[model samples]
Target: MSGMGSKMLELDDEDELKDFRACFVDDRSGVNYLDGNSLGRLSRAARDSIMTAIDQEWGVELIRGWEHWGELSFAIGDTLAAELLGAASGQVVVADSTSVNLYKVIMAAHSLVPDRRVLLADLNDFPTDRYILEGIAKANRMELRFIATAMDEPVVADDFAPYLDDDVAVVVLSQVNYRSGALNDLAQIAYTVHSVGAMLVGDLSHSVGAVPIALDDDDIDFAVGCTYKYLNGGPGSPAFLYARRRLQAELTQPIWGWFSARDQFTMAPGYEPVAGIGRFLVGTPPVLQLRALEGALTVVCEAGIERLRAKSLRQTELAIELFEQVLAPHGFRLASPRLGPERGGHVSFEHPHAQELTSILLRDHRVLVDYRAPNRVRFAPSPLYTSFAQVYEGIMALAKAVES
Candidate 1:
């Protein structure tokens, strides 16, 4: 092995989260998987939990399973709120997809300040988020504005200042940039948005389990995130929504399904929404997916988010170091923040041929990663399942792939 490879192995040996890697089912496909920011590895606990739910809960208990499963959404939400989001109970609920949750929260926030006619978001916001804003703006006859920012830079409070007028009702921003892996200052942006009486809606999809977030401390009004990425939840798992305790009473989501009905079981005569976070829920929760996430979260809660964040920072730092030393010579330029604290769980690089290179790395080099847009390749080192050695090998493989 090379000297650098030996150093990485040593770091892995001392890693505190080393034991947690065994909790996941490694396919042993010999691929250096660095796409955890896109989708996390499956955990053994999640598999067992799903099987148990299918055999015992569903087969044996059958329809009676509702007795225990009735409140599973809220129960799981509370766990996520406490462990992952740094939020209080009764403020968060697990339901719907990230896009759907964003719609609900953004619409609810807009209603709070109906007189305002403009909705604002980052110019490079995720495609789905931009689509949702466009739809909402057209339907409500409101103007939607974007805070323009370079692809490599994050949208900071300063960027939003010029657009924050009395007409701006809701300001939406992602806690972490999906493409650049840049971390935004949530507290500062929240303070800035609140200053103008505009509500701040945070999209936590890229930061949730991989980074430490204090929604309450930041005074963020509403937030949403997916569990399938850093949380190790299975594919198509429900996303979570957070509405501050103060906002729950006044806000109402567009969807008014039976699950959100005040008396869900009563088949109520009217469309009265339930009180608290339960009102955000639109339909019956996906029991099996929720179970998978619940089971997977046990590992995260046990390891703790602070610890996870520390390891994530170190791993990403290592990746950046390797990139500077090797990949830069091969035409890769750092697209993410150079400072670890300003970055999320991953590091991204820009190359003219990033898309084609990504395909070669996956098909030929067995280095799994994802490519974005015009030119970005993201390498996500999940602290729980990804080791320092994997991060080292993944970048090294990318360097070799470029050479060949």
Candidate 2:
């Protein structure tokens, strides 16, 4: 290792949270892991919890497993709200995929503002987001408005200001922009949307466990996110939904599922929406998938989101420093914001050879980071499992990759 790289490792050794790194099993030894923003390391808690559920709950109980399976969604949802979501229990539910949840809330939010014929969105927001709104508009025969742009930059706060009128149904955006890691000022934007009588929705896919969020305090009408990232719930884990309490009664969902009926098991002939956020649920939920997230949340709540966030900031700061000190000379322009508060738990940098460089680092250097289109590399500091040493080692490997 270079003298600077060795010092970065020593800097990590002095950290108090360094010992927590051993809690995860790693076959990618001699590699640096910086991909936690995309997928987090499986925690020992998740591993043990899943095994116990399989062996004791499902294996032994079998048909009698309905009791444990039923409350798993709400139970986990309660913990997420109390610890991470910053809302009351009934406000959040682990159900369906993110796209499904987004569709449910988008249509329902429109219903609340009947005359609103336009849907405003970021042209550069995640592709799925833009596509979803387009589909919504096509279904309703409305216009999809893009934020005004000049000099090739995206629409900022001013662009949103002009569009905030009663005619707009819902304004959708990412809480933390996916590709750029730019954090939108949610509370301010939420207030703005409400002032103009529009519902505000955020896709927290990149922010939820990576940063602190308060859906209730912000008076956000709706929100959705994938759990596979920082939640470490494993691939295809159940995504979560949040519908503000005040709007719960006014909004009606598109899908009418048995689990969401007033008396779900009565075999009711007609659809009567159940009270509270449960009405948003559709179809029979996958208990097995919910169980994985349940186990993961156990670890997350135990550690406290506040502590995790603090460590996350430190880790990202260190990674950026190492890049500026070591990799910047080799040809990497910081893609993520330098101001910590404005960015999420991840950092991205531009490298002309990013795609091929990622392949070389993963195959030869054992350093793990992901590449987006064009020329960008994203490094996530998943506080629950990532450590300062990994950041130091990963960047040093990147510096080597740049040379090779």
Candidate 3:
């Protein structure tokens, strides 16, 4: 180990959350994994649970497992709601992908106020979100308005005040910016949207699990997020959506699969949607993937989201400190918020050759950080398994890559 590695180990020795690292499978011993914001590292619990789901649930119980499997989506969703999202039990359901969930909620929002002819969204939201909003706007013949925000600045409630009006039916925003890790104030944005009689559709894909979210308390009209990222649910794990209980009766999603039918087994001719959050379900749940997510969520619940959030803030602060001390002198600039509370779990830096440097770090040095478009390298030190020592080593590797 190098001098920086020794110092990092000293910091890790003092970290109270160091025990949590044992829960994950650390196969790449020499590689520092820093892309948890894009895809979380799989935990050992998730591995064992998936095996049980395959061997015991499928191999032995067979089709009979559907009896309990049928409710896994809602059950797991309720767990996520209570543990991660500050939401009510009957308000959230796990189903579909983030794009599909967004489509359902956006359509529901449009149906509520059919006369409104404009849809509002952030100009720099994730590409999939922007694509969904574009399709919705084109399909409904409604005008789409985007709020231009600074790359490094968080989007606050005041940012929407100038653009919001009676004509805007829905305001779509991401709780955290994917590239910069800037955290938006959900409560204030929800209030601002409601004040203009517009529904707020939040994309919590990057915020949930990494940061604390209060969907119900904030009065968020609709929200969608994926389980594959910070949730550590494996690749392509099912996504979840939240629809406030009060809005369930009035909202109607476009998809009308058997799962969402009032009496699913009836094989009914007409499509009668179920009451509450179940109405958002489109088709049969993915049992294997759901099981994987349940296992991962079990770990998250055990650790406590609040504790995870505290540690995440601390890790990010340390990463920023290291960047300022080492990488900043090498022409790298901070692209995320300087304040811990104002940012999410990741720390990003803008360099002229960020993409090339990211490749060099991965290929030559075994450091793993992801690069965003243009010139940004993002490092996410997951609180669950990532150690402060790893963050220090990753930055040192980045410094070497810059020099090379």
lDDT values for all models: 0.90, 0.82, 0.91
For model 1, how does the per-residue alpha-carbon lDDT over 192-223 read when each residue is reduced to its tens digit? Answer: 99999999999999999988999999999999
- Between candidates 2 and 3, the lDDT winner: 3
Residue-by-residue lDDT tens digits, candidate 2, 1-404: 47766776776677655655666666456667788878877877677777878898889999798876878778888888889988998989889988888989999898888888989988778788888899989988998988833311222567699867778889998888776687777888888888888898889998988789999888888999999898988888888999988889988798889888998888989999999988988887877778778777777776677878788888888888888888899989888777778878788888899999889889998888999877888888788777676787788788888888
**Runs of candidate 2 exceeding 4 Å displacement:** 1-3, 26-30, 148-156
For lDDT, the strongest prediction is 3
TM-score of 2: 0.94
- TM, every model: 0.98, 0.94, 0.98
lDDT of 1: 0.90
Better of 1 and 2 by lDDT: 1
Off by over 4 Å in 3: 1-7
Itemize residue pairs with steric clashes in candidate 3: none
Q: Which stretches of candidate 1 lie over 4 Å from their true place?
A: none
Residue 305 Cα positional deviation in candidate 1, in Å, after optimal superposition: 0.9
Which residue pairs in model 1 clash with each other?
Answer: none
